[model samples]
Target chain A: DQQVKQNSPSLSVQEGRISILNCDYTNSMFDYFLWYKKYPAEGPTFLISISSIKDKNEDGRFTVFLNKSAKHLSLHIVPSQPGDSAVYFCAASALPNYGQNFVFGPGTRLSVLP
Target chain B: DVKVTQSSRYLVKRTGEKVFLECVQDMDHENMFWYRQDPGLGLRLIYFSYDVKMKEKGDIPEGYSVSREKKERFSLILESASTNQTSMYLCASIPGQGASGANVLTFGAGSRLTVL
Candidate 1:
Protein backbone atom coordinates (compact mmCIF):
# COMPACT_ATOMS: atom_id res chain seq x y z
CA ASP A 1 0.00 0.00 0.00
CA GLN A 2 1.18 3.51 -0.83
CA GLN A 3 0.97 5.51 2.36
CA VAL A 4 2.34 8.59 0.69
CA LYS A 5 1.24 9.65 -2.78
CA GLN A 6 2.24 12.31 -5.29
CA ASN A 7 -0.37 12.08 -8.00
CA SER A 8 1.28 14.47 -10.46
CA PRO A 9 4.00 12.82 -12.44
CA SER A 10 5.16 15.97 -14.19
CA LEU A 11 4.67 19.69 -14.11
CA SER A 12 5.84 22.52 -16.36
CA VAL A 13 5.99 26.21 -15.59
CA GLN A 14 7.55 29.33 -17.03
CA GLU A 15 10.27 31.24 -15.27
CA GLY A 16 9.18 33.87 -12.78
CA ARG A 17 5.96 31.98 -12.19
CA ILE A 18 4.96 30.12 -9.12
CA SER A 19 5.31 26.34 -9.10
CA ILE A 20 3.30 24.16 -6.83
CA LEU A 21 3.73 20.46 -6.08
CA ASN A 22 1.23 18.57 -3.98
CA CYS A 23 1.42 15.41 -1.84
CA ASP A 24 -1.02 13.36 0.20
CA TYR A 25 -0.61 10.86 2.97
CA THR A 26 -2.85 8.14 4.42
CA ASN A 27 -0.97 7.36 7.63
CA SER A 28 -2.17 9.49 10.49
CA MET A 29 0.85 8.74 12.65
CA PHE A 30 3.11 10.68 10.26
CA ASP A 31 3.82 14.02 11.89
CA TYR A 32 6.94 15.12 10.08
CA PHE A 33 7.09 15.95 6.38
CA LEU A 34 10.02 16.74 4.12
CA TRP A 35 10.78 17.59 0.49
CA TYR A 36 13.81 16.49 -1.46
CA LYS A 37 15.06 17.38 -4.92
CA LYS A 38 16.98 15.07 -7.20
CA TYR A 39 18.80 15.46 -10.49
CA PRO A 40 19.66 12.89 -13.10
CA ALA A 41 22.16 10.26 -11.91
CA GLU A 42 22.42 11.90 -8.53
CA GLY A 43 21.09 11.19 -5.07
CA PRO A 44 18.27 13.25 -3.65
CA THR A 45 19.10 16.37 -1.67
CA PHE A 46 17.07 17.71 1.20
CA LEU A 47 15.13 20.85 0.41
CA ILE A 48 12.61 21.84 3.08
CA SER A 49 10.69 20.30 5.97
CA ILE A 50 7.71 21.07 8.15
CA SER A 51 6.67 19.85 11.56
CA SER A 52 3.14 18.78 12.35
CA ILE A 53 2.77 21.57 14.86
CA LYS A 54 2.85 24.28 12.20
CA ASP A 55 0.75 24.89 9.12
CA LYS A 56 3.43 26.59 7.01
CA ASN A 57 7.16 26.90 6.80
CA GLU A 58 9.05 29.22 4.47
CA ASP A 59 12.63 29.67 3.49
CA GLY A 60 13.45 32.26 0.85
CA ARG A 61 11.33 31.56 -2.23
CA PHE A 62 10.38 28.06 -1.10
CA THR A 63 7.40 27.47 1.13
CA VAL A 64 5.67 24.38 2.48
CA PHE A 65 2.13 24.30 3.75
CA LEU A 66 0.55 21.40 5.61
CA ASN A 67 -3.13 20.80 6.21
CA LYS A 68 -3.62 18.17 8.87
CA SER A 69 -7.33 17.88 8.27
CA ALA A 70 -6.86 17.27 4.57
CA LYS A 71 -3.87 14.95 5.06
CA HIS A 72 -2.19 16.95 2.31
CA LEU A 73 0.93 19.07 1.97
CA SER A 74 2.34 21.24 -0.76
CA LEU A 75 5.58 22.89 -1.76
CA HIS A 76 5.48 26.27 -3.46
CA ILE A 77 8.30 28.01 -5.24
CA VAL A 78 7.75 31.64 -6.14
CA PRO A 79 9.39 32.93 -9.31
CA SER A 80 10.53 29.53 -10.35
CA GLN A 81 13.93 29.39 -12.02
CA PRO A 82 15.42 27.04 -14.57
CA GLY A 83 17.75 25.73 -11.90
CA ASP A 84 14.71 24.61 -9.97
CA SER A 85 13.94 21.95 -12.54
CA ALA A 86 14.23 18.59 -10.84
CA VAL A 87 12.22 15.75 -9.35
CA TYR A 88 10.67 16.53 -6.00
CA PHE A 89 9.86 13.84 -3.47
CA CYS A 90 7.65 14.13 -0.44
CA ALA A 91 8.52 12.05 2.62
CA ALA A 92 6.63 11.56 5.83
CA SER A 93 7.58 10.11 9.22
CA ALA A 94 6.05 9.80 12.63
CA LEU A 95 7.29 11.33 15.84
CA PRO A 96 9.44 9.43 18.47
CA ASN A 97 10.58 7.14 15.67
CA TYR A 98 12.51 10.01 14.06
CA GLY A 99 14.61 8.65 11.20
CA GLN A 100 13.74 5.03 11.80
CA ASN A 101 11.69 4.81 8.65
CA PHE A 102 10.45 7.46 6.24
CA VAL A 103 7.85 6.78 3.58
CA PHE A 104 8.44 8.55 0.27
CA GLY A 105 5.98 9.40 -2.45
CA PRO A 106 6.40 8.60 -6.13
CA GLY A 107 7.86 12.08 -6.76
CA THR A 108 6.91 14.90 -9.14
CA ARG A 109 9.13 16.03 -11.99
CA LEU A 110 9.11 19.81 -12.31
CA SER A 111 10.36 21.54 -15.43
CA VAL A 112 10.97 25.27 -15.50
CA LEU A 113 11.14 26.90 -18.90
CA PRO A 114 13.38 29.88 -19.18
CA ASP B 1 30.09 19.70 5.64
CA VAL B 2 28.81 16.19 6.23
CA LYS B 3 29.89 13.91 3.41
CA VAL B 4 28.66 10.42 2.65
CA THR B 5 30.74 8.42 0.19
CA GLN B 6 29.88 5.28 -1.70
CA SER B 7 32.52 2.81 -2.80
CA SER B 8 31.39 2.60 -6.42
CA ARG B 9 29.40 4.68 -8.84
CA TYR B 10 28.51 1.81 -11.16
CA LEU B 11 28.77 -1.94 -11.14
CA VAL B 12 27.75 -4.76 -13.46
CA LYS B 13 27.33 -8.24 -12.15
CA ARG B 14 25.95 -11.57 -13.30
CA THR B 15 22.92 -13.26 -11.87
CA GLY B 16 23.54 -15.31 -8.71
CA GLU B 17 26.82 -13.50 -8.09
CA LYS B 18 27.58 -12.03 -4.73
CA VAL B 19 27.52 -8.21 -4.67
CA PHE B 20 28.62 -5.74 -2.09
CA LEU B 21 28.02 -1.97 -1.81
CA GLU B 22 29.91 0.09 0.72
CA CYS B 23 29.14 3.46 2.27
CA VAL B 24 31.19 5.64 4.61
CA GLN B 25 30.28 8.81 6.41
CA ASP B 26 32.71 11.34 7.88
CA MET B 27 30.17 13.18 10.01
CA ASP B 28 30.27 10.64 12.82
CA HIS B 29 26.55 10.24 12.51
CA GLU B 30 25.10 7.32 14.37
CA ASN B 31 22.33 6.50 11.93
CA MET B 32 23.05 5.05 8.48
CA PHE B 33 20.64 3.75 5.89
CA TRP B 34 20.48 2.06 2.49
CA TYR B 35 17.81 2.62 -0.13
CA ARG B 36 17.05 1.72 -3.70
CA GLN B 37 15.54 4.11 -6.21
CA ASP B 38 13.59 2.97 -9.20
CA PRO B 39 11.29 4.67 -11.67
CA GLY B 40 7.86 5.21 -10.07
CA LEU B 41 9.13 3.75 -6.80
CA GLY B 42 10.77 6.82 -5.36
CA LEU B 43 13.16 5.70 -2.60
CA ARG B 44 12.51 2.43 -0.80
CA LEU B 45 14.53 1.63 2.27
CA ILE B 46 16.37 -1.65 2.29
CA TYR B 47 18.17 -1.52 5.62
CA PHE B 48 19.42 0.80 8.33
CA SER B 49 21.87 0.80 11.23
CA TYR B 50 21.58 2.92 14.30
CA ASP B 51 24.99 2.08 15.77
CA VAL B 52 27.91 -0.17 15.27
CA LYS B 53 26.92 -3.82 14.93
CA MET B 54 23.24 -2.98 14.84
CA LYS B 55 20.93 -3.34 11.87
CA GLU B 56 17.27 -3.37 10.97
CA LYS B 57 15.35 -4.28 7.84
CA GLY B 58 13.37 -1.64 6.00
CA ASP B 59 10.48 -1.75 3.57
CA ILE B 60 12.26 -3.92 1.01
CA PRO B 61 14.88 -6.12 2.60
CA GLU B 62 14.49 -9.23 0.57
CA GLY B 63 17.70 -10.52 -1.10
CA TYR B 64 19.71 -7.98 0.89
CA SER B 65 21.74 -7.90 4.07
CA VAL B 66 23.67 -5.21 5.90
CA SER B 67 26.73 -4.98 8.10
CA ARG B 68 27.80 -2.17 10.38
CA GLU B 69 31.15 -3.07 11.88
CA LYS B 70 32.02 0.56 12.50
CA LYS B 71 29.98 3.62 13.23
CA GLU B 72 31.09 5.49 10.14
CA ARG B 73 30.66 2.68 7.64
CA PHE B 74 27.65 0.63 6.51
CA SER B 75 27.62 -2.09 3.92
CA LEU B 76 24.85 -3.70 1.84
CA ILE B 77 25.31 -7.17 0.48
CA LEU B 78 23.33 -9.17 -2.00
CA GLU B 79 23.71 -12.88 -1.41
CA SER B 80 22.54 -13.72 -4.90
CA ALA B 81 22.05 -11.03 -7.47
CA SER B 82 19.07 -11.14 -9.76
CA THR B 83 17.94 -9.12 -12.74
CA ASN B 84 15.22 -7.45 -10.73
CA GLN B 85 17.77 -6.32 -8.14
CA THR B 86 19.37 -3.95 -10.62
CA SER B 87 18.71 -0.43 -9.45
CA MET B 88 20.29 2.72 -8.09
CA TYR B 89 21.39 2.33 -4.47
CA LEU B 90 21.63 5.30 -2.14
CA CYS B 91 23.37 5.66 1.22
CA ALA B 92 22.33 8.23 3.77
CA SER B 93 23.36 9.30 7.29
CA ILE B 94 21.80 11.48 9.94
CA PRO B 95 22.99 12.67 13.32
CA GLY B 96 21.58 10.57 16.12
CA GLN B 97 21.18 13.30 18.67
CA GLY B 98 19.59 16.74 18.76
CA ALA B 99 16.71 16.17 16.40
CA SER B 100 13.15 15.19 16.98
CA GLY B 101 11.39 13.59 14.04
CA ALA B 102 12.51 13.20 10.45
CA ASN B 103 15.86 14.93 10.46
CA VAL B 104 17.17 15.83 7.04
CA LEU B 105 19.28 13.06 5.54
CA THR B 106 22.49 13.65 3.62
CA PHE B 107 22.94 11.28 0.71
CA GLY B 108 25.85 10.09 -1.35
CA ALA B 109 26.13 10.28 -5.15
CA GLY B 110 24.51 6.81 -5.38
CA SER B 111 25.67 3.49 -6.82
CA ARG B 112 24.01 2.00 -9.88
CA LEU B 113 24.06 -1.79 -10.03
CA THR B 114 23.19 -3.71 -13.16
CA VAL B 115 22.74 -7.46 -13.00
CA LEU B 116 22.79 -9.45 -16.17
Candidate 2:
Protein backbone atom coordinates (compact mmCIF):
# COMPACT_ATOMS: atom_id res chain seq x y z
CA ASP A 1 0.00 0.00 0.00
CA GLN A 2 1.45 3.30 -1.08
CA GLN A 3 0.81 5.85 1.64
CA VAL A 4 1.78 8.69 -0.67
CA LYS A 5 0.95 8.94 -4.38
CA GLN A 6 1.97 11.24 -7.19
CA ASN A 7 -0.56 10.57 -9.91
CA SER A 8 1.30 12.31 -12.69
CA PRO A 9 4.39 10.58 -13.87
CA SER A 10 5.69 13.60 -15.74
CA LEU A 11 4.99 17.24 -16.45
CA SER A 12 6.28 19.75 -18.96
CA VAL A 13 6.13 23.51 -18.69
CA GLN A 14 7.56 26.49 -20.49
CA GLU A 15 10.23 28.56 -18.86
CA GLY A 16 9.05 31.66 -16.94
CA ARG A 17 5.70 29.96 -16.36
CA ILE A 18 4.11 28.58 -13.23
CA SER A 19 4.41 24.84 -12.62
CA ILE A 20 2.14 22.97 -10.29
CA LEU A 21 2.76 19.45 -8.99
CA ASN A 22 0.25 17.54 -6.95
CA CYS A 23 0.50 14.74 -4.38
CA ASP A 24 -1.93 12.74 -2.27
CA TYR A 25 -1.52 10.75 0.88
CA THR A 26 -3.60 8.07 2.57
CA ASN A 27 -2.11 8.30 6.03
CA SER A 28 -3.73 10.72 8.44
CA MET A 29 -0.91 10.47 10.94
CA PHE A 30 1.38 12.35 8.62
CA ASP A 31 1.68 15.91 9.85
CA TYR A 32 4.74 17.13 8.02
CA PHE A 33 5.12 17.11 4.25
CA LEU A 34 8.26 17.84 2.24
CA TRP A 35 9.29 18.16 -1.37
CA TYR A 36 12.67 17.16 -2.71
CA LYS A 37 14.26 17.89 -6.07
CA LYS A 38 16.59 15.33 -7.60
CA TYR A 39 18.86 15.56 -10.62
CA PRO A 40 19.76 12.65 -12.88
CA ALA A 41 22.89 11.52 -11.04
CA GLU A 42 22.52 13.20 -7.66
CA GLY A 43 20.65 12.66 -4.44
CA PRO A 44 17.34 14.34 -3.77
CA THR A 45 17.68 17.69 -2.01
CA PHE A 46 15.15 19.39 0.22
CA LEU A 47 13.08 22.07 -1.47
CA ILE A 48 10.12 23.18 0.63
CA SER A 49 7.88 21.79 3.33
CA ILE A 50 4.50 22.48 4.93
CA SER A 51 3.20 21.47 8.30
CA SER A 52 -0.33 20.24 8.77
CA ILE A 53 -1.02 23.21 11.02
CA LYS A 54 -0.47 25.63 8.17
CA ASP A 55 -2.07 25.62 4.74
CA LYS A 56 0.94 26.91 2.89
CA ASN A 57 4.68 27.55 3.03
CA GLU A 58 6.87 29.45 0.62
CA ASP A 59 10.57 29.52 -0.13
CA GLY A 60 11.93 31.73 -2.83
CA ARG A 61 10.49 30.50 -6.12
CA PHE A 62 8.88 27.42 -4.57
CA THR A 63 5.64 27.26 -2.63
CA VAL A 64 3.96 24.26 -1.01
CA PHE A 65 0.29 24.14 -0.09
CA LEU A 66 -1.33 21.54 2.08
CA ASN A 67 -5.00 20.66 2.35
CA LYS A 68 -5.21 18.44 5.37
CA SER A 69 -8.91 17.83 4.97
CA ALA A 70 -8.40 16.48 1.49
CA LYS A 71 -5.17 14.72 2.32
CA HIS A 72 -3.57 16.40 -0.65
CA LEU A 73 -0.71 18.81 -1.24
CA SER A 74 0.64 20.74 -4.19
CA LEU A 75 3.95 22.37 -5.03
CA HIS A 76 4.10 25.47 -7.16
CA ILE A 77 7.17 26.94 -8.77
CA VAL A 78 6.80 30.32 -10.41
CA PRO A 79 8.92 31.47 -13.30
CA SER A 80 10.21 27.97 -13.79
CA GLN A 81 13.75 27.84 -15.03
CA PRO A 82 15.59 25.26 -17.11
CA GLY A 83 17.54 24.33 -14.01
CA ASP A 84 14.28 23.26 -12.37
CA SER A 85 14.03 20.28 -14.66
CA ALA A 86 14.32 17.19 -12.50
CA VAL A 87 12.33 14.63 -10.58
CA TYR A 88 10.30 15.93 -7.64
CA PHE A 89 9.44 13.60 -4.80
CA CYS A 90 6.79 14.19 -2.16
CA ALA A 91 7.44 12.74 1.26
CA ALA A 92 5.54 12.75 4.56
CA SER A 93 6.44 12.08 8.16
CA ALA A 94 4.90 12.20 11.60
CA LEU A 95 6.14 13.89 14.79
CA PRO A 96 8.62 11.58 16.54
CA ASN A 97 9.35 9.39 13.54
CA TYR A 98 10.41 12.47 11.64
CA GLY A 99 12.76 11.40 8.82
CA GLN A 100 13.27 7.81 9.87
CA ASN A 101 10.20 6.21 8.39
CA PHE A 102 9.19 8.84 5.87
CA VAL A 103 6.79 7.60 3.21
CA PHE A 104 7.73 8.81 -0.27
CA GLY A 105 5.63 9.19 -3.38
CA PRO A 106 6.62 7.70 -6.73
CA GLY A 107 7.83 11.11 -7.98
CA THR A 108 6.99 13.38 -10.88
CA ARG A 109 9.51 14.23 -13.58
CA LEU A 110 9.32 17.96 -14.29
CA SER A 111 10.75 19.25 -17.55
CA VAL A 112 11.09 23.00 -17.83
CA LEU A 113 11.17 23.73 -21.54
CA PRO A 114 13.64 26.38 -22.52
CA ASP B 1 27.51 20.80 5.70
CA VAL B 2 26.54 17.28 6.63
CA LYS B 3 28.08 14.83 4.19
CA VAL B 4 26.87 11.29 3.62
CA THR B 5 29.28 9.25 1.53
CA GLN B 6 28.56 5.99 -0.17
CA SER B 7 31.64 3.85 -0.62
CA SER B 8 30.90 2.89 -4.23
CA ARG B 9 29.11 4.86 -6.89
CA TYR B 10 28.44 1.71 -8.94
CA LEU B 11 28.81 -2.03 -8.65
CA VAL B 12 28.23 -5.17 -10.72
CA LYS B 13 27.95 -8.73 -9.45
CA ARG B 14 26.68 -12.15 -10.44
CA THR B 15 23.87 -14.12 -8.86
CA GLY B 16 24.45 -15.55 -5.40
CA GLU B 17 27.31 -13.13 -4.76
CA LYS B 18 27.32 -11.48 -1.37
CA VAL B 19 27.30 -7.72 -1.72
CA PHE B 20 27.96 -4.97 0.76
CA LEU B 21 27.11 -1.29 0.33
CA GLU B 22 28.78 1.05 2.77
CA CYS B 23 27.76 4.54 3.88
CA VAL B 24 29.46 6.98 6.21
CA GLN B 25 28.33 10.32 7.61
CA ASP B 26 30.56 13.11 8.86
CA MET B 27 27.95 14.52 11.23
CA ASP B 28 27.42 12.44 14.32
CA HIS B 29 23.79 11.97 13.49
CA GLU B 30 21.79 9.46 15.49
CA ASN B 31 19.52 8.51 12.64
CA MET B 32 20.76 6.76 9.50
CA PHE B 33 18.73 5.18 6.76
CA TRP B 34 19.06 3.05 3.61
CA TYR B 35 16.62 3.45 0.78
CA ARG B 36 16.30 1.99 -2.71
CA GLN B 37 14.97 3.91 -5.69
CA ASP B 38 13.62 2.30 -8.84
CA PRO B 39 11.69 3.49 -11.85
CA GLY B 40 8.01 4.07 -11.09
CA LEU B 41 8.60 3.04 -7.48
CA GLY B 42 10.23 6.15 -6.03
CA LEU B 43 12.17 5.68 -2.81
CA ARG B 44 11.54 2.74 -0.48
CA LEU B 45 13.16 2.34 2.87
CA ILE B 46 15.26 -0.80 3.44
CA TYR B 47 16.71 -0.27 6.88
CA PHE B 48 17.62 2.37 9.46
CA SER B 49 19.78 2.73 12.51
CA TYR B 50 19.28 4.98 15.49
CA ASP B 51 22.52 4.43 17.34
CA VAL B 52 25.64 2.34 17.36
CA LYS B 53 24.86 -1.40 16.99
CA MET B 54 21.15 -0.68 16.84
CA LYS B 55 19.15 -1.14 13.67
CA GLU B 56 15.54 -1.28 12.52
CA LYS B 57 13.94 -2.71 9.40
CA GLY B 58 12.18 -0.33 7.06
CA ASP B 59 9.32 -0.78 4.60
CA ILE B 60 11.31 -3.10 2.30
CA PRO B 61 13.82 -5.27 4.12
CA GLU B 62 13.14 -8.59 2.52
CA GLY B 63 16.44 -9.42 0.84
CA TYR B 64 18.60 -6.96 2.74
CA SER B 65 20.29 -6.56 6.12
CA VAL B 66 22.15 -3.67 7.73
CA SER B 67 24.93 -2.93 10.20
CA ARG B 68 25.88 0.10 12.27
CA GLU B 69 28.81 -0.83 14.41
CA LYS B 70 29.93 2.74 14.77
CA LYS B 71 28.21 6.09 15.07
CA GLU B 72 29.42 7.37 11.72
CA ARG B 73 29.20 4.27 9.50
CA PHE B 74 26.31 2.14 8.28
CA SER B 75 26.40 -0.85 5.94
CA LEU B 76 23.79 -2.61 3.86
CA ILE B 77 24.35 -6.27 3.05
CA LEU B 78 22.77 -8.45 0.40
CA GLU B 79 23.06 -12.06 1.50
CA SER B 80 22.63 -13.33 -2.06
CA ALA B 81 22.53 -11.06 -5.04
CA SER B 82 19.71 -11.46 -7.54
CA THR B 83 18.59 -9.64 -10.64
CA ASN B 84 15.61 -8.23 -8.80
CA GLN B 85 17.97 -6.46 -6.41
CA THR B 86 19.51 -4.32 -9.11
CA SER B 87 18.68 -0.69 -8.38
CA MET B 88 19.95 2.57 -6.93
CA TYR B 89 20.70 2.52 -3.22
CA LEU B 90 20.73 5.70 -1.17
CA CYS B 91 21.91 6.45 2.36
CA ALA B 92 20.71 9.34 4.46
CA SER B 93 21.33 10.78 7.93
CA ILE B 94 19.51 13.19 10.23
CA PRO B 95 19.94 14.57 13.70
CA GLY B 96 17.90 12.86 16.39
CA GLN B 97 16.46 15.80 18.25
CA GLY B 98 15.97 19.45 17.30
CA ALA B 99 13.72 21.70 15.31
CA SER B 100 11.45 20.21 12.68
CA GLY B 101 13.93 21.33 10.06
CA ALA B 102 16.42 18.88 11.51
CA ASN B 103 14.21 16.14 10.11
CA VAL B 104 15.55 16.97 6.70
CA LEU B 105 17.98 14.24 5.77
CA THR B 106 21.31 14.68 4.09
CA PHE B 107 21.64 12.01 1.43
CA GLY B 108 24.57 10.46 -0.33
CA ALA B 109 24.92 10.60 -4.10
CA GLY B 110 23.76 6.94 -4.33
CA SER B 111 25.16 3.56 -5.35
CA ARG B 112 23.85 1.93 -8.49
CA LEU B 113 24.04 -1.84 -8.31
CA THR B 114 23.63 -4.37 -11.07
CA VAL B 115 23.00 -7.97 -10.13
CA LEU B 116 23.13 -10.31 -13.09
Model 2 regions lying over 4 Å from their true place: none
How many clashes show up in model 2? 0
lDDT tens readout by residue for model 2, A62-106: 999999999999999998999999999999999766467689999
Model 1 agreement with the true structure over B93-114: per-residue lDDT tens digits: 9987675323888899999999
**Alpha-carbon RMSD, candidate 2:** 1.1
What's each prediction's TM-score? 0.97, 0.97
Docking class of 1: medium
Q: Pick the candidate with the highest DockQ.
A: 2
lDDT of each: 0.93, 0.93
DockQ of 1: 0.66
